[model samples]
Target chain A: MSTGYHVAVVGATGAVGTKMIEMLERTTLPISKMTLLASKRSAGKTLVFNNQSIVIEELTADSFEGVDIALFSAGGGISKVYAPEAVKRGAVVIDNTSHFRMDPEVPLVVPEVNAHALAQHKGIIANPNCSTIQMMVALEPIRQKVGLKRLIVSTYQAVSGAGAKALAELAQESADLLAGKQPEELSPAILPAGSDKKHYPIAFNALPQIDVFAEDDYTYEEWKMINETKKIMEDDTIQVAATCVRIPVFSGHSESVYIETAEHADVAAVKQWINDAPGAVLEDDPSQQIYPQALNSVGKTETFVGRIRKDLDVANGLHLWVVSDNLLKGAAWNSVQIAEALHQQGLVHV
Target chain B: MSTGYHVAVVGATGAVGTKMIEMLERTTLPISKMTLLASKRSAGKTLVFNNQSIVIEELTADSFEGVDIALFSAGGGISKVYAPEAVKRGAVVIDNTSHFRMDPEVPLVVPEVNAHALAQHKGIIANPNCSTIQMMVALEPIRQKVGLKRLIVSTYQAVSGAGAKALAELAQESADLLAGKQPEELSPAILPAGSDKKHYPIAFNALPQIDVFAEDDYTYEEWKMINETKKIMEDDTIQVAATCVRIPVFSGHSESVYIETAEHADVAAVKQWINDAPGAVLEDDPSQQIYPQALNSVGKTETFVGRIRKDLDVANGLHLWVVSDNLLKGAAWNSVQIAEALHQQGLVHV
Candidate 1:
């Protein structure tokens, strides 16, 4: 535990990977060396760390040879191909993709919610969905105080979560629209789902679909939140439904979550629990018009919870608004937190 | 009923008023004459109606002297001050403001959901909130097939609903942000809520508060939706909860609505009812990726309902995605529809 560890960050040129490096720089984990891996297109690119320029390498099977911890965030395909190779090379791969999330052997980890589940991971731990991660940060504290029975969430997700290209698309499309050009004439190559054949403008419009549509008409993004929350909470009995939407926001993801607890929980008590929890901030002062704003949560690693109130008609129902930087707490910071937890428990091997 | 009518469009220079004029041209109502009325500042402006230019006149107590039906799209203050005067001058005011919506004398109408409510109006008929109108169009059909018990909605509203200045602010601030300038440096004079001291950029963000804050910490926009839904349905006991958010969308309003019906209902039955409803267009075939989108419904008057599905856990619970042009069906068209209803029923006096 005292020795320095070797870490490798996959997708180093991407949004979440860049934040992972930043989070690592502020962490107490003694990093002996850091390796940046990306596609061949981005290989040989230089990124600064500790005042020195380190070149990103093209990822391959041998990339994880001496790495103790590997954070994979390229995409589901890359993770499916390289994660096993990383694991075989003795690195504990923490995948930030949906590829291995539902694989029973892979434990979906949201450190605040289910860090203990990390002990059961077989060389690879899966990061929960961005929308799910933020909700878990806000709900776990309350769930611990009073059990959760049912949940409904509607997310206002950001384009940056789709990657750098989508963010650029929004900027360009917005500029074109303001210039009086037809929005349709402006090519949409990045969103609402990049891999989906047709793209829609995200500049001043909301795309209700996030990720690809799955069976039962639920998008993969919504299914991730539903399934990941259950796996992270280890409660298959909890009823969960999600409507994940892509808004024009560039960074933070905001959610309006309604929950019915097993026990009737008072708003004040739940607010107190959220305030007392680590990595959770309470911004629910209605009198002062204080509530979480996506604009304010950018670059931050904590989940901002606000607008906590009991339902007027349903005795056990409570509603809350949760906001957090999807690239940070929802991805990079959460991945780094898992590595930290694993290191503290002496679970990582070189 | 067969004869042409003399229609007066109050607040003719405003957002909804302008749209009302456009809708009237496309509507089945035969207009013998069209009068455009506005405040002193907007007087002398010319608007074309049916290939003829009509000069805008300053609205006064005597403005409605020869008007058969007056469609009001002015603010609540102007509606309160001038609606009675218009009624006294032999015109029936179809008001698109909240000033008279909850009044015992004024019937809150969504033409599709409660056109019959218009028959109860003495002299003025009130239009429901933009968010409520869209939801009611999607849900009333379900309510008819299977009685509605509770409704929970979270809205992704557009900036145009706030007025022209707010839309301009959003555009200006967006341009500032693209130039790498701070949003605060742009000086937001109107947004989130115009009367509120603080304003946030809606360029790429979602503001949870739409109107001014009301009792129970809900925004006035949220309260208006809740109260207006009950009054329009004439069911005080039906539970409704709303979370209204202002997104960067310019025109269309989108909502994620969850409902519980008194009787057990399947997705197919619900879809059929919505498809057959007067103003509702079902866009919900999930397999082909056919679903309601805000961009598609921007200038359209139809309320698009899609993603209708039964909840996995609750037998009576259903989820729907509703979208409509906030200025059209939610305001202008509804106002004009009331005018048409009034003229047909002999409620208007020329």
Candidate 2:
């Protein structure tokens, strides 16, 4: 509601960062000043906003001076280094990395699920994982009604979640494959997991692992879902498990989730709850062949939930299919939304 | 084992039928003569088996004359029409369609899971759904160790399950998209579901619905997972729910499964059970980044199980990642395995 505020976006050259700029343009929050921050390698590059050319600045500890809000998305390492520096300069930091999500002092926020938790943030707030954010939007209403006991989720993740380069790799490699090139002949340097040495082609394949491997035979991506859900839900006792997979999709993360509630739940009531929730759209009309699809969800801000049903024989079990643009709700839009919420709640100083 | 037995393969030249021929070449079942049958359109086309060219004949009432064992994979419509004809000719039919899967007289069989059910087959045996077969292969061993109470599965299925033309569409459309063509500009005559009026581009996208839409907002693919699971497990009381998704992968099907057992189970004990099973392979070493990946399981016959873990808060909940070549273990290989089982058990005769 303020006339204008100073906002700084880190990782300005990345996938989510570009979306943040777009969202900021359409936002009601008046941006009197904007700073585009990226690594030294991308410094001096210009991105146009509001018919004005803005040069990307190399982010340093001193970069956040006079900035009211800093959005960090330059991976966990960059976030760990620069997020605290931004907070020290009196900026409210909304991090889009896993570095601060599980931290006891950081408030993990999904506005629809836990906007109130944002009030307790000590300078830095954490954005939930892309797969987790979309699911939370779809399930929080049901959890409010029946009280969730357990959740099991499997994701169909897009290449864009990995970054712009990964998306390019999918497009290029796919073109190569169809042009009579062997899969092994095409060099793969950026899929399945970036840090891992070997890269498998994801153009016509599904990689079962996301992120690097972790203890207990689960990928770090799966662990992030398990740990972040507990933090966002504010319940360490809630049962959660996830299997993250990278499919050929260019945008949107789709998940198949099954939940058990504390009370016996009917599919109809749960459907009603999802349809009524903010930022959630119900597309569940199986009789007419209507449901959420990835192609239909791109560039959209709403979390689409459909295929809602109860377990055939379980007392209180329910199933849902959830999809959302990963770069939007999963990253940039969530960060911008949090900035909007903070400004509305008078939590930020201009 | 018999030295020679008259055999028939219905639905010959289809996706699964082609793989069935390859599997039979490597199988040990003795055959005096082999008969190939298909719809009238595909009839007279020659397919090679064991280096011999055999012409396909039109499937009709008399097509099963003197056949000892028959494998059917065309579709439900073909099976409902000609399966009884095969039975009337004194041949035992193993159908890979849903036509007779739920019938009281037909036995649903996964040779490794419930080969004993083959004994109750009046004349036709039902092969479980492609997605269901892979999960059962991975879970049945653990269930025998600790009884299963509930199951939730989300599948990343390949377009090849839709048939050969679908695979071509996915490849061609992907090429068209990267070449800067809009998906709508690329005509999709096949994919997602061929019978459905509308077609979706499977290139770089995920279609949440597979097969046709069924009652209760669940897809026929999802219903098949639920209904076929109970029949194969021989327990209508077990809880099951599924969301089937079609990804761009050309071959293997991957699933994220969560199960609750009747007794307390740990990840280690469950891992041991799967490692000990005949057809199940445990590839769950997260430290080395070893797990079941669709790229690695493309030409293999085994069902790969990995990412096994117990839910942090639930006493009996466990999660698993399962993948197998949908054309092989899910269909052709399982069908051929059933024939081998029948021959080994002295159930087939000329």
Candidate 3:
């Protein structure tokens, strides 16, 4: 290879992995070599990058040979199996699964909030959960300006976060529903949680559960938000609570976020902090009927925040509406951002 | 009139008004005569009540001459103009519009929570806003069991709350979107808030604004939740904050509700309280993947409560998912229930 580093994208055919390729194409990171990897099912499939056709290679123990970086998004099982293998082959793995996120040695990083944590990476850097990633980008400004005391968020998540299959399911189910098919008559093979035994129709409906139940009856998605926020912000003292709900939207995730800051900041100052923050766009003029909307946030890389107001009762409490494209900023763009950060910090070379 | 009340339903052709007619048909209150009233534009229409086709009459100041109970739901403007006229014409008004909900003279009643307030109504008993009514039914039991200190709720409201025309707008916009039309290409006349200057599509997306902005940058819908909760519970000391959102759901309104109780209560006690509460159904079974889903709650009169869990940090903090049919329990049924309470309390006479 030339002076640039080699990069491999596992799960190259999946939803987020597809966007990861697009992000890689647009990213300024120098790449003399690119490797597209996936499971055996997608091994022979070809995807385009830089106007060149690239054949997908099956991920294996030796697939990371000479690779400077490997971005993994296949699933937790695949990540648990192949991530360490990739790392052993001298590739820094940026894992996009829940498998290694909570590992004490694994640095869960959102470059906007915790890029410095990349220095502590021991070959594996866990990308924070999609919901947590966007939230970190939106709230890090507030956390930096005024110490965050507590956070309570209710998410209006889209089906894309579940994967490409969930997106197809939403499309098919919605088509079936609009054709006058009874909801009970339609079969939903995947939704809410694919690993879970049950499936529900997500077209024109809201599922209060995202992933399987974890400790204290919270879903793994909720726990991911709660724990990942702490890990990313690097402050376990900030109490976080989350209710993750899957709405019918296909791409963007919207959140109704409530926060209690350690210090009092007026709405104007808070807006200014968000306006000044990178990767965050303020869309909050109520007089002009301007606010962050799910449809408007689609295809956008920035986190859109609006409806910022102080709590009528609590002096330090505030509320905001946050929206972002789950596939872009929440998953693919974030992983690529980490890779860019790794490159900028000279941590990409193994 | 034959030992029964003569009931008049204003806005008889509306989504809630149609449900009100259905509710009256099933109500325990004896209605000897039913008068259907609407605007002059809908005056020539006919609606069936109790298997009888009733001719719709244009609502005027003289429409409630002999009516003992007048249910006003056309709009806030109409209610402001006609509710007092109905009451002056010897009728007890149960207004479903927000025109008089916060009036000190008009008692805001969610019958299950504050039916006793009906006895003090000065010829006008106000039904709380659609979003507020369901929340009251779910939380009143908890408030009674362990005093509520503070509540923060984020609502996933339905399109029908905007009325019949908004429902039509959603259907058309959804069909156009499904046919591969761009979001901007579709003409959306009503949504988010019709009276507001701008409109947004509600098909497969979420809008953070539910109504016009009010004081402190809160939407009028959010303020309705905050102010009406205290009014209906008759506890001005209970601190409430709300973020109201309009989602793609057709009927049911779902909320992510978090509350801090005055005293400690475990999950089991909270579940038991919800299970025992009138008009509240407990659907929370985490292992079974059961929660209050919007689609499943459609057309249901009772508010479904689920996803009940304690906060990981705060001892007294609790969270719940509450869903209800916005047209039924949230509007018509709640108003009819209030009428029943007034009848049972011997307060229906002029």
Give the number of the best model, judged by DockQ: 3
- Top-scoring candidate (lDDT): 3
> A201-246 in candidate 2: lDDT tens per residue?
8878788778898766677888999998888888887888888889
lDDT string for model 1 (B1-350, tens) is 34687789999988898999999998887788889999999899899988899999999989888777889888999899999998888778888988888899888888777877777778888888889998988988888887989988889999999999998988888888999987557787788878787777787777888888878777788889888888888888888888888888889999999999999988888888998999999999766667888878877989999988778778898889999999999899878777777766666663
Q: How far is candidate 1 from the true structure (C-alpha RMSD, Å)?
A: 1.6
Per-residue lDDT of candidate 3, residues A1-350 (tens digit): 26888999999999999999999998988988999999898898899999999999988889999999899999999999999999988999999989999999999998888899999999999988888988888899998988999999999999999988998898898888878898899899899899999999998889999989988999999999999899888889999999999999989999999999999989999999999999999999999999999999888889999999999999999999999999898988899999999999989865
Residue A231 deviation, candidate 3, in Å?
Answer: 1.0
Candidate structures ordered by lDDT, highest first: 3, 1, 2
Q: List candidate 3 stretches off by more than 4 Å.
A: none
Residue ranges of candidate 2 with Cα displaced over 4 Å:
A1-3, B1-3
Tens digit per residue, CA lDDT, model 3, B64-86: 99999999899989999999999
- Candidate-wise lDDT, in order: 0.88, 0.87, 0.91
The superposed Cα distance between candidate 1 and the true structure at residue A35, in angstroms, equals: 1.0
Which DockQ-derived CAPRI band holds candidate 1? medium
Clashing pairs in 1: none
DockQ (CA atoms), all models: 0.67, 0.72, 0.87
lDDT of 1 at A105: 92
Q: Which stretches of candidate 1 lie over 4 Å from their true place?
A: B1-3
